[model samples]
Target chain A: MAKQFNQLAYTNLDDFVYGSCPNPVTTKSGMVIGGGMVYPEINFTLPGMDINDVTMPKAATIYSNIIEGVLKRAAELYAPGVLIEFETLPDFTEHPKYGIEVNRILLNGMKEASEKYGLKTAIRTTPNDLREFSRPPVMRSGKYWETMLELYEQCARDGSDFFSIESTGGKEIHDSALVKADIRLAIFALGILGCNDMEFLWKHLVDLSNANSCFAAGDSACGFANTAMVLAEKGFIPHVFAAVIRVAAVPRALVAFEQGAVGPSKDCAYEGPYLKAITGSPISMEGKTAAGAHLSPIGNIAAAVADTWSNESIQQVKLLSEMAPVVAMEQLIYDCRLMNAATLNGQQLMFRDLLVQSDSALDVQAYVLRPDVVMRISAELVKTQDNFLRTKLAAQLTVAELKKAIVEGKVKSDKRDMKWLDKMEKAIETIPDDPNEFYNEMKSVLDMDKFIPSEYGL
Target chain B: MATLNDVSQCVLDGDLDGIKVLVQALIDDGTDPIVIINDGLIAGMNIVAPLFKSGEMFVPEVMESADTMNEGMKLVKPLITDEDIPSKGKIIIGTVNGDLHDIGKNLLVMMMESRGYTVIDLGVDVKEEAFSAAVKEHKPNIVGMSSLLTTTMMKIESTIKQLVADGLRNQVKIIIGGAPVTQEFADDVGADGYSDDASTAVELCDRMMSDQSSSEALSA
Candidate 1:
């Protein structure tokens, strides 16, 4: 089944400059083979050789050592065909005197390491307005693009197999639109540079292309999932790309990656599915742990699909490889999506559904539909939400009624009717009869003031 | 006799052009620059600060208003001169080691500068020794360290530890901030203050300085 799926979905993998395998590789222990890339430690030092400052040399040396260590680790742990990515430190342009030199030294060191270790590298250039690294002649308008291209050329010259270009510096310049344009421009610019070692360059270019194209949508979560599905559909699922997919399915993978439990690239794709599953739901161990565990299954499926189709459609595999890094780099895209979904759903549950009870009977229907909100509201009402609601609704009700509700704990309801009262009575019987505790817990969940019209000018 | 209410309303409406015109008219009519700034501009900023904290405005809008306030300050700064520059207090601020991002730090600098404090900006990726040097050289009332990345935030602890080792920890209160930085982290590092945004940084500085003065007075 996996082989057949690969044959149908990935006919273009063979045309890639790199080889592809659609089927999963199984080891002697019967475990599937998967791979990922880890981001190196943040190098804070300015990169340069001629800077007279004592810190410059130390920074350069530290950066170089980090790259060397990463390369050595990658070689020791993975097979030669396995892909590893090293994200070059962003240039610090605020301190121009040493910033330019520091970036140069860092890039030069990275290039040397790539050559020696046969590693792939990606460079995120300083935003163009920043005083770091002189603007290249080709980039009179998009100066940052030219600077990044120069770094790509250097990487190419130094035997780097891949390059990922991202625009993340310059306060005025690094908007979402500009970032997308920059990535597209970098792709065309790199293509025009006439250095066509297709396998290496295409893989990196595909990653940026996926990231840029998806980010253009302006919804981080949707963009993340959309990018992963798009890349997978396109057969750009390299080992590192697969890692990104895994991260999309599991967000804790990010914490794990940061903690060095899993390689950075390994969990790249896990965040999306993990977030989608948990959106608007109680953060059950089922969602968090189950979503995390699901990565292994998807990873296996993706690997099987890749391995079986490796020989038949190298071109498609190559395309997949090219586009996969974007999945890895933008795991936060899924996180943003989950947050937006949660906020939207929570609003709907609270405002449009929860308050519209038909009778004195508590309408468990809405609560049933949104059990997470029910639990959240139940817990919050006992703590903070009731006070807020009480204060907000106090003006609408009779002062006598309001005081009785506060003191004697029996209040008439106009909105919920008699059915709600019966339901409340039944609910009270099943739980602690302490209305104050229940009201406080409910209060803890709802900030009724946020829903109310403000007293001041709009 | 214009109250803070009128000035605050003017700021909320983003009537910078009107503010400038009104301020210039006040100056022309012989109103003191310090009084106009304190009663009008600073009063206006105090309102804007809470708005910013509440997410009523984002970074760009805050920065734009800060820029407007800066222009107004430029007109007033020259009028005051060296002798007239009131000493609210001195602060040394920088992004901690291994973090180059400084948009928050820069905003805090501009906001602090507007509030009449002497600010020594140590710049990004600042080392512990450099911070120690600045503290020793300037003898500032407070030292502020910022880190935007979780990885770089670890440096703040070492920097504070270094300050303690150098015997300068007790001399200057420490304040920490940035995107990833938390008050819990600040407490862990023994920092005297933590602010999530630039306006809050100014408020914290004001409170910290006043507290220091009161403590000194009690000791004396």
Candidate 2:
């Protein structure tokens, strides 16, 4: 079982600043994520590698070239410390050996880069979650789960400095709710199903990481909130709804830290700020720099509270001057350099406030990410012991804040969009505080055919 | 007793239980089942389609409304035979090979179904052979593919190639969507249409079906 968070990680919001966490994780290569200054975590993808072409040799060559290009550029730019994340293609992990071999390749590149350039570096190996390989994917206890565990173990043993995954525990439910814009079901997915999966999965990963002496870096809500973020970006859903769902996702991601994963949460998890506020975990966040991977509304504001700023993920394709990953590294290094300079000059808080002020009022998505807002929402979040109630309180508080911001003319929003806020507030108000009661009510209401309760051990 | 307007309101409110009660009440009041469907259920969705496109109603509200309509339909659909009902068209859709992401595809499915199309959902990571097989089996008016990953989007071309290889290319119009998918990519891959969002995808399907019928009429 995971440890329950009964209180906020810190007392004073004003002093709850970025560039550090309660449990800072130092990697095998002496790369510290939350020790003091913010570092760049560069995530890169294979350049258009087809699923059929993901053999061991091809993965090795492709990853080597990509990392060499990124690190070589980092060396040229005189980057102090960098973190490279290898998020596996599903095929690489479907065959666990290939996944392990690829991890070894990535680690070797990081080692060589550190030795050759006299630079400090670490590698985060994130195995692709393949439980979704089954249609109406069995979320737990299947061949896919077994192989996923095997890959994690081997990768950790292979000297992966950090362990992370974009786990899809409740994605089957969350995806359905997201498309429907059903916040009630979305809460059920994130607060209940997702929390259960995180506890179960993270417990094992933490154990494995401990056994192998690696950092159990936190998981991402990539399957949940990121999906909503992208859908909102495409105008498939309202930004207000996506913004509220982002806050609702905090409890689920928080389960990772409760299960003993330390710091530097996954770069793709935008819920990192709330988790950082609640659990004091070092969080890797991506924003404007991640436009190479995906476009988002909270570009500048996302960098406000990050311990490790990342470029999300860039492909290894070539640009006019350099490879895309190399270009991404140069951009990220400069961003980190500026941020570190601010910290060195005793102006980190001023820089953080500037980042927060830049984008917070422009959009509701950006507004909720403001450090003050994160702390405010997270304070209410820790008031509840139930995950369902935590999710509801998160949504209710965010809606209330957005409404307040709109009324104050701080955050501009259309009048018609107010109906959604009202509707969500009304819906959240009707939810029971007890998780069991809420679960029962949801079971009676939601379309159970869309997901398997058995998979979540419901 | 509930009026047809009340039934429509139930859908608009996404009152699933209310819709069931209202639909049953209308049936008990001897309301014509077809009138209830066209005027009550679909009429509500018609309002939703525009509101959704206009961004007044979001995807969840729209889907809730659609699900309410489905719930209401369950009560009335049994009273009639297949020929008595109207379907917009048949659509075969799936996420392309090597891509398991289907929230977008599922939204398109729901939107298409709510608009009265018969949708055959092949689910995610669908291979080219499966797509061609679905087309051959269902003889759909349109084929839609979704790919959220840049890497897996390349599979859309291969899937289209398989359709052409199977000599099924001319039978149905092809459409593609997803974040990374674009109009140029669709044209490059020989897809007949592209839409960025689910509502637009529904509109694209309607336009393509209309165009196909018009072309067939001219040929005839």
Candidate 3:
């Protein structure tokens, strides 16, 4: 059975700061993830590099070198500790045999670099979700699902310290809901389908971690909320709508912890602050530093309460004087150093407050990410044990706050944006608190042809 | 006693159940199906598209309006002959192989369908052979491809190549869209058109269809 958080771990926002978790997991490399100063989680990708389908030798060499170069840069910068995340491109993990070999080589590089530089190092292996190998993706069982499990098992056996995945559980429906901005459907996708998939997927992931003595860090709503944020950034969707979806995704992401994921949730899950408040799990957050990966309104404010500050992911391409990943390492070390300095000076709270105030009122999306705002919505969220109710309550609280902020002129808004607020509020009100009724109504009203209920065990 | 205006209001409100009732009422009251479709359902959707572009309307609202119009379409469509159906063009669309991302593609589908283009959605991770087969079977006026991954986006070029090899490339106009897709890339790959957003994709299709019709008129 997984550990479940039924109440807020830290009632006072002041009690909740970066670099600490109530239950921090210590890695085998003797690096502490939480309960200390903030560390940089370096995530980098192949620079427009494609993995060949036939052989592993060339891909393995290229990837292993990237790892060595990043770790070497970290050592030269005198960075205290680092968690290097290898987020596999789909082609990497589509075939488990080649994927396992690639992972082994990358882990070898991390080990060598750590021994050479005396730097505290750990590795997070995030396998790409290949469940989309089939249309109307079968989440619970299939050859694709089996391949995902095989990659995780072998990666753990190969000495991966942390296991994470940006799992695509309810993405089929969630994608449609996002484009349509259907709050009711978004709730069903996130609360019903997404929560169910998390419990099922994480149960096995947590079990694998326990058997291999690895840490099952957590999942991210990177595909869901982050997609909404990007669309909002492009002016394709309203920022207010993205803000509401961000809060709505919290309870769904919290399901991962409910199923036993520990501290330091994935980067790009901008909903980290709310999950941090509720689960007290140290979360990895990327902000201004993550601009190379994606842009958003919550850049500075996203770092306000991050336990692990990260540059979401940079390509291994070169800048003028140095490689891009190396440049990112210098930037991240300086960022974590500043954050760690504040913690050491006993002025972390003052720094945290400054971070929040800088961007919270600038964009509606940023307003919801404020630590105080995360706390208020999270407080009401924990009142219910049901994931669906928690999702609804979170959305309700966030919508109320956003409306008040718009009226008070704290966050800029267009008069037309009010219709969205009203529509969202009305939609939330109409959803029956009963999950079963909501599910059935969604079945009737939604484009059910695009969804497979059996996959979610409905 | 329901008027066509009542059907339009239901679509504007995105009241799915109300749209069903109002559309059925008009059918029972002896209204012409095409008039109800054009003046009522599509008319409401026409207003929604601009509002969406102007930020006065949001995605979900526009989606609801699309769903509402679609529901009304289902009721009125059966009453008309295939030749009488108003269509801007037919489109075969999908996210190219190795890329499962389709939120953008699905939005484009909705927008295209709302604009009276008959879009046959092939869904995500669609292989090159599948696109060739779809073009052969559907004989669509235009083919659309989408890819959200830089890794999988190369599949678009390969898929277009397959279309050319299969002798179907010149038969249909080819367009592409997605996050990483650019007009420069599209041109490099020999695509006829590219769009960054769903609304603009619809407009591109409109322009492509018009140009195609104009060329045919000149040939005749």
Candidate 4:
């Protein structure tokens, strides 16, 4: 309820500590046994080779071993009066049922490690392989969210207090945006579990421009975190936006005033730089971009905002194509092993120093017609970007243009496109935009007439 | 007195309930079930397929339309005798082992079925042995495989190998599809062909079937 947020007077980033990441480590031996995306970094540092070179079955073994090492490390870090949290990359559990069993075995070990070692400890949730399917009239959550929540719920029942929502799927424009809604909705649903201590460690949402990189799960986690924080900051429902170009010699500066959270599947890796730069209050300022299993898109997003009201979790939406049980499942190992072995400091710092141009400094009129300006610029940029789905700026900017067309009587006022667009843009228009309402509006657009029921067959 | 055009309209409108009411009326009028299926329902699906390829219809809408066709088929099926049901073809489809995504695979099944083909959906995470066993059991005209992830996509090749190892590869034509699949990928995997989407998938199956029959006829 909007009433829930009116209760909060204010919340700020000063309430937290600056988290630190690790530098690239050296291999103790010539043989790189493990400690990369596919292995637990207990004895071995990252090797020069690709993590995917290790078979998945072998990687699964390494992942299980990593869980064992986290317990060992936690025991050493634990003290009676102190609480410690660490990142675990026990990615890609074999079969869902067997994976659950493995999780229980590890959780029992974790609880034992906590009690025996005399420390309060928690590990972030690991995502299972995702499979979205269509079953006519609904897009069912096949193995992806169903298995994730099952594992999450099992952890909760078994005394795992710290939980995060992790989900991954659909790398298209409408698809990823739909995935965002699914993640937000899942996070909203999982919030009821009373797991207030949430963290962002996910299978990345957007695709990277790097020819070498696979999907970066952490990038998704970070964007989710930013959206969560942004949701927390505004403290209200209605959200609005104006698409604008604030570009300079380096492209990073172009995004300053907007503070946008871009979600695209490929080549739009800008979300990573935009995400890594944000500093916010979380359970811990620290995070681990480990080489996780390239399966589920981790959905749960959490930040320790300066102030968090109970039961106030982000609520987004779900429902992709008209078919409920027939979602497409496509996978990429997305081994970010080389980068995962290294630190995020380079990514954060890389975007920090770029030359920036500004449009935020313009007059109030510029702000009022910002969406119009977005269209003009995106239209120009479209010529440069052959990969349209990879970038949401033009599509969203066009949505902004579509709205202007309706208002000026150039398009039908009662059109489904206009109605859904109006709802989303209006939600985006709200100063403290409602992530729930905004996400739902975008989702509704996918459920329109032309997309489904038409006088023509098929 | 309902013509086939009326049946096509029901499919286009994605009106599941309407399909039953109209099909029932035709049956009441003593219309032959085979004619209803061939000229009515199948004709409607043929039109829908093109619209779908043109992006005029999406997955959800197409699925809805497909659902309507299935609904109409229920009434027509029982009425049409085995003599009237000379099978166009039979297909066995499944997503490979460790690869559970099946939207594309399922879509192809629906498209093929509408064209008077029988389909056996083996479902997601199907193992190689399962494919061989199913091919033996069903003796399908085509064995369709799908994998959404690169990690599991290799299973497509392995499954192809298993089919050959089982010696069932000669019995059935193999077609594969998914997000990462391509014509080159299809060629490398030694597949009969690749389909970029569900529409072309049916076309791929039809062409393969025609070729198979043509070769058999030539040999005879």
Candidate 5:
């Protein structure tokens, strides 16, 4: 299980989760990659067709062509990963059968391009109304799940590396709690069937934080930050960080970097200034902030470079190479820190800006050792043996250590002293029995203390 | 003899087994199938729909109630011969060409069916000609179109334009909807109605049909 949790061993899983590569880039000159995470807009207009006589295949061809163009261009650019998110118009005729056909065509096209270029890809189906139990009828009817399982099984059989099922908006269905349960069920079912290839993907860490804002607000960004913290603490690697550096930084370095871009969008409302306040910086500048400032510049640089590739095709390749390592490291370090923090806190640790107060400028080599520094600091804090320090440190440790301590009574606290233990237990129950449960249990136990109570006093 | 109140009580209690027995009793007692449907099953749905909209009842409860209603409908539907099935209006619904998504479409069909609309679903990837052919054959009062893909959304307009060119545009009202179908898009396509969900589709279709029937009566 510990070996499986290692990122290096992730690709070996039968069903692996998919994530976008960091540092989307352009080639030196020629190509343009404009569409970011959103699905690229396509011209839906059919040429030379009388409305009454327009054929299904002809209409489908337009979409097929657009997808082909994008994938071909991505292959040429040599992108390590790309995400395809689904959204649709609410026409009654657009039933499951039609959706399947569309998905089939796109998947086929993606497969063809992936085979040709060895490009990694991720797919995100759109959010359906979980409150209504209304999914795209295909999905609601269970056929979609069956189809997905089959597709995954075949992919596993074919030695295709990564795939994932993601729900959007943290809505009822996409709720982390619900998704965790569903993933467990999927894994158990798949495992029982002897189809060991199954993986759950987590993307858009920033988005998840944003959606869980009310919970975060209640806990002073604790709930918002806790999901990532818990996942990391549990030794579960998040599939994608989705602007993690931006989530924790002062003034959110990503926003400033994006603001510097050609068409800069506003910083997400929930973050922006509030995050800046927490991080103790008025505005984050490039190379100034610890996290996003260092990484966002790379993404900006990659985007710029990718834009110049030969017709966006070669640009993707350049972007992937540049971004892959950064993304991998960002995810790895963030998860590791989260695990450490949660275990030490003896509760889910709230995400906070890791402010390293250095007396002087440090080289990249010095900064690379920050993880060890954090682990050391955490260990010292725990040994203080003060109740508060012990409590805090218990919440801060990695899941493995936290679980061991809890079981061994190394971190002693009475039932009353640890009110969060119950909540943590419930959260742990949500995960399936994947030997990963040990870590998840630790995460859940730690998170309870981070949750702000509804009232000032019990 | 089971009365509408009896059926309503059964629904309220979520007694699918009891509802089934009561419905059978209603049929044996010679109550008109349509009367039982309207007064018993539909009445119960009408009672629950508001609760669902108001958040008084969550999804699971509504689904269970709908399931019960569907069970009752199954029994009543067979008793009602083809001639007895009341048609609020005839509708030809399909996903636009190239877009093959149907969850939204299915929901709309279920809601519309519950409300007594006779719908001919052309399924996904329906071409313009097929839509026109269905319209011509069914002489539907309205055409409801759905699309899930932005890429395939434009097919709705093309289909409408084709209907107009074939001199069938004035004969029927077109309603368009889906995740991306905005009111402005519906207007641009010369569609009479646009709605976001299956529940809304039912309401919109009812209003459209009522207006058409009233205008026809006024002309007469």
Candidate 6:
């Protein structure tokens, strides 16, 4: 069961299918190895050099250091490949052409790391981070797309092992059919350039592709969830994730088992799955360390599947033991009792560290049950992004509804609090009982609202 | 007949060709250029603003309608005399220095223009000195700074300081906004106003200008 992928000389889909096996087997000579994108931090330049001043060749050391840190852990966990994305900090003003320099620096580092560790490397393009890097994506324009393809062609020539082509249709082209078409056209171009060993962002494309593409959709609580069964018919590569809402995780576990996609490449333990389900960060972070929370049951369920597939205990008793306290703390955070206690500083990271790393529920309860600790934790997470997004969305809804309620004479003058509750209850009545429909329609509305400034008359 | 409704619809639909044809027919029909602009083209754009703010309309479509407004403006501009032109106020706006995000500023500029204000758009990634220089030169009634990064948003304070240092702070109303900006941040930074979105920014501006006029009358 040793996986063999032609570096970048893929001709057909069967080559990819051979690599993306449906089941994991424990054989020293052959394993259906899992891989993922790594954001292991490194300067990518001389150790102390400014990020803007980073130049290639000398930068290979930084890449090697970063890739080495990420891969060593990945390998320790039995995962084989790692995806590298070019994150241009500051801006892409220098070598802004298709992020060529940035990718070269990463590729050089990957080549060094692969040789050093005997691991596979893939450049994930779906969550390109180009926007953060200060450049538009290929899908931004035909010319940009053509130019990006040429740059990738150069990367293939310059020794990129594999490419993960995920087309995230931006504001202008977000129709599902258009997203698929964009991915198809991109794959066609990459194929023409003789690129191989691919990961299509969506599993359905992998199911339909002639290029043995495996699914690399990030663990967006629902990545490839809609069609995991369809992909399981071909091979299960859909991400299995925990959801923020508890009830949603059950069907997810079933799909993961049905699809045989026990890959860490598409799993998020807590905030990752929750955020991805609501927002569209399919391949968010793979680890739960940063999120500082547990995935209710999906995390264990996913671990159990891995345990069964690999025939290893994959002990999470310690991880699970830490959860009860965090669960209680999360309830406190969710209810927002912490915000009224004090203004939090540094996002109260001390709480995340203490609560997430507790050896047992007893330790967490003893540590967190104190008033001082609760205040510290609450204020910090309130100011933090995870809470901010959820709170902001709720606030926006209430404000919009309040205006409507006032207009409709539903709320009488001066009884604001009661009127707000009345409006909120009325608003809840409008949403159907179906969770799936609510999530889908909410996602659509949010996507439209979030479209870039130009759409709003900019 | 080229009713204001037709003009409004053409602009809302982003029919540039139709606007050119219809606006010219209105010119021949002896329609007031001010009415053609205020009740027709601008009426279409005003509809676009709230729809866009509410997320019912998209940017590309809004740009089309804005472009129609511009086209109709070209047709109607010469017809209105200097005295016929009603000045709302002057505004200087830009995405603050080191920030490339300006979608909000662009929409605000379009909305301000339709409201009959002269806007000097400094464009994206404008440096603090550049903002100060624009203020010094343009002498606008309001200075609007935009940013999408918390890191770059610090530059908003610096830009404000630069304005004060340049002795231009008292000459203008300062308003700040972006994804990360809050009304609390506005007060913290000593800005006169802060709005979360573009449409609200226009209303803020109008209200601020009215306040300014009331103050001036009292001072007088």
Q: By summed lDDT, which 10 consecutive residues of candidate 6 chain B come out lowest?
A: B52-61
**Residue-level error in angstroms, candidate 3, position B123:** 1.5
Per-residue CA lDDT of model 2 for A1-458, tens digit only, reads 55777777878766566677776778777777788778899988776546554344675787889888888889999888898888887876787877787778778888888889987888888988988778777877788898888998888888888889998887887887787677888888888888888888899899999899888898898888887888887667778888999999888888888888887899999989898888877899999999988898888889887988899888777899988888989998998888888888988888889988889888889999998898888888887777767877888899999989988898867665688788888888887877788888887767766677778778
* C-alpha lDDT (0 to 100) for residue A92 of candidate 3: 70
Candidate 4 chain B lDDT trough over 10 residues, lowest sum = B55-64
Model 6 chain A poorest 10 in a row by lDDT: A307-316
Superposition error at A382 for model 1 (Å) = 55
Stretches of model 2 off by over 4 angstroms after superposition: A1-4, A53-59, A383-386, B1-47, B64-80
Using all chains and alpha carbons, the TM-scores for the candidates as numbered come to: 0.42, 0.91, 0.91, 0.48, 0.43, 0.44
What's the TM for model 4? Answer: 0.48
Over 4 Å off, model 4: A1-165, A168-458
Q: Tell me the tens digit of each residue's lDDT in model 5 across B1-220.
A: 6788889767655678888999999999999988888888877777766565554543334455666877887898887688786678898888887665554575566557656678898877789999988888999998999975455678888999889888899999899987567899889889998997666677889899999999999999
Please identify model 3 stretches exceeding 4 Å from their true place.
A47-50, A55-58, A446-448, B1-47, B71-80
Candidate 5 lDDT over residue span A1-458, tens digit each = 00110011112121111111122222112111222221121111223232222455754675476457666655554454443322222221224334444455656666776778775543322222111122212222244344433333333233221221222111211122211322222212112111111011121222232233200010011112223332222222121111121122111111222112111111111122221221211111112111221222121111110111111001111135343222322332333243234435532212111222231012111121122322332333323422222222322332233334345554433333132333333433454434334234434432333222121111
Q: After superposition, how far is residue B37 of candidate 4 from its true place, in Å?
A: 0.4
Residues B1-220 of candidate 6: C-alpha lDDT, one tens digit per residue: 7889999999888898999999999999999899888899888877887776665554445667887889998988898886676657999999986676654677688778866688999877788999999998988999999987554677898899999998899999999998667888789888999997777889899999999999999999
lDDT for each candidate structure: 0.40, 0.85, 0.85, 0.41, 0.41, 0.44
Report the Cα lDDT for residue A202, model 3: 89
Q: What CAPRI class is candidate 1?
A: incorrect
Q: Per-candidate interface C-alpha RMSD?
A: 13.3, 2.3, 2.3, 11.3, 12.0, 12.3
lDDT of 4 at A264: 14
Candidate 3 structure, TM-score to reference = 0.91
Docking class of 6: incorrect
**DockQ category of candidate 4:** incorrect
Measured against the true two-chain complex, the DockQ scores of the candidates, in the order shown, are: 0.06, 0.49, 0.41, 0.07, 0.02, 0.06
